[model samples]
Target: MIQRDHIHMLIQINPRQSVAKVVNLLKGGSSRVIRTEYPEIEEFLWGDSFWGDGYFVESIGNKNETVMRQYIR
Candidate 1:
């Protein structure tokens, strides 16, 4: 999980569970934790009283130097 004010998650888990189910669970738990840390973060975590409505999932591949540097920076 990568979190700023919002978040970007890159997860690798077992194949038995459906991705949608896993995403919902993770989103719910993370949202709760974020709220605990900073109540104000709730607004960012759930813009307009909703957390992310969509997610992008992909398999990892060889690192792109440009993207890697951007992430580190």
Candidate 2:
């Protein structure tokens, strides 16, 4: 899941899942894990919504860096 300048994980979440729910779960879980492993990232992790409202999901093909960057934006 590690790239030179980034990382890409092929997670297979439910297709019908709500983006908000998924984002919230991920954000909360990730922050907790980061805090548990190392506390320094906590300050850098706190935000209103780290993920955008909408998502660009690619189920059939590989997503390019530009596309992934836009998705994370």
What C-alpha lDDT values do all the predictions have?
A: 0.66, 0.58
lDDT for model 1, please: 0.66
Q: What would the per-residue lDDT of candidate 1 be over residues 1-73, giving only the tens digit for each residue?
A: 3465455545567878788899899878866786778877655543454465887676556867567546644
Candidate 2 residue runs with Cα over 4 Å from true position: 3-6, 42-56, 61-73
Report the alpha-carbon TM-score of model 1 versus the true structure.
0.56
lDDT of 1 at 16: 88
- Candidate 2 lDDT, 8-46, residue by residue in tens: 444557779976687678757875786789866546644
Clash totals for all candidate models: 0, 0
